[model samples]
Target: MDDLGVTVSAGSYRSTDPEAVHFPHRWSDEGVAVQAAFTGAHLLHLSAAGCVLNDVYREAQRLGVAVAGVRVSATGDFDTDTWVSRGITYSVEVDSPAGADDVAGVLEAVDQVAEIPRAIRAGATVRRVPAAGQE
Candidate 1:
């Protein structure tokens, strides 16, 4: 779907010292709750992983597949000195009564719908711009 694209409401309110930021995100498309923790990189990864898992489970349910026996696990491999992720190993194991082929098909479909997996497989480019008086 997403004919109109996803809609979300997010805002960040930080204190005067700017030591920390309180960020909140809401799903405006369906009045759902989406949360984000304003911590560092590690916490951000956990939040992103949790969002991906929820997205996968929701898609499976919409396709009439049972995900009660599903297990999702993820780990991060990163170098702090370089401040980059070497890789993220994530997997999903489904224990449905369906046959092996069926389970595989369902997982494939889920992966197709989840955004994070697609982004991971096909890299994205980012260009940073300096703010008005920063440079």
Candidate 2:
């Protein structure tokens, strides 16, 4: 991921920034940390990154793999003329004491099971409904 990327990390790599916003998690006591700006493009990548981070922990536990931390970063570009996405690319990292093959297995499972990434891969139906009492 480059400068235009967004990252979400949790567990051992979770942010300690005073200004960082954290979201509640079922697996971690400190929650998840977000390391991106407030923008549409960042938000789009963030959804993928955050989902990956969460899935790493979820899938690890389900597989009985010990994951101490997780980080996911995603980046994308757009066609300036149409503002259509050029697609997003993402990466994942996990800190664990488990065997390499175990960690790899968990990562593979997460890749197949993460919901946001699947939704994006299948394309999305985005629509704007009229605001209350406005239509």
Candidate 3:
């Protein structure tokens, strides 16, 4: 039921599902570590939150901080009947030796670079075009 798809110029594609379309990519590729989703709003929510959390973890690691665990959940006021999300909220929990100050910084950092989360929070325009010689 997803109408959107992604084309990565050549190597691989992560398209709408339940087709589960995935292409083989070399383990050495940067994308090997970054998975994409085309599963609509909820998947977007998860991806956005995850992206922020990943960044936080990366920065924490660089700072020599140990984060034992991290969990993120998204809740929203969405109208399925209207096919729109009215409001969304993200909740995060982290088990770490980093104090409240550091955790607060992580949260702030999430605000700065969670692209997908920001996309959901601020709606976007999406268009679909026919592939290659299709009509």
Candidate 4:
């Protein structure tokens, strides 16, 4: 089977607050070695939202609809027991000159075809291999 791969590098610690320069002193002092600039859960939501936004634009173009802007927000609850996401939700707002029915149709089509959500719903197997020089 053909496999697709993506790689990301770890980032240093960062503050959650927009204005803060760094995480609070207490968290920094706790000797947390595996800190990340952003959490994995947040990245998952971002991926979904980004896919939806891009699909919306692509579908609108194909349908000959003029869109001014698109906004999508996604959130999900993580189940501690299962270590998996539960009840993911996303809200989409599109600024367009098209009729309401046309806009709605575009959104619905995008929802059906967004890749990340489709992958999650269909389920994909993930395997880890050691990085070069690690083993």
Better of 1 and 4 by TM-score: 4
Q: What TM-score against the true fold does each predicted structure earn? A: 0.52, 0.92, 0.61, 0.70
Off by over 4 Å in 2: none
Off by over 4 Å in 3: 1-39, 62-64
Superposed by TM-score, candidate 2 places the C-alpha of residue 9 at a distance from the truth, in angstroms, of: 1.0
TM-score of 3: 0.61
Candidate 4 lDDT? 0.61
lDDT of 3 by residue, 1-135 (tens): 332222221112222344333344332132212233545665655566556556656666666666655555554545669977666566666667779888777777767767776776677787899998996
Compared with the true structure, model 2 gives a TM-score of 0.92
Which one wins by lDDT: 2 or 4? 2
lDDT, ranked from best to worst: 2, 4, 3, 1
Best-performing candidate as measured by lDDT = 2
lDDT of each: 0.49, 0.87, 0.54, 0.61
Per-residue lDDT over 19-97 for candidate 2, one digit per residue giving the tens place of the 0 to 100 score: 6788888778888988888988889989988888888988999999988888888999888788888898999888999
Select the stronger candidate by lDDT from 2 and 3: 2
The numbered model that scores best in TM-score is: 2
lDDT per residue (tens digit) for residues 48-119 in model 1: 454555564566567676544443455565575786666555565555666777767777787677777566
Worst lDDT run of 10 residues, candidate 2, spans 1-10
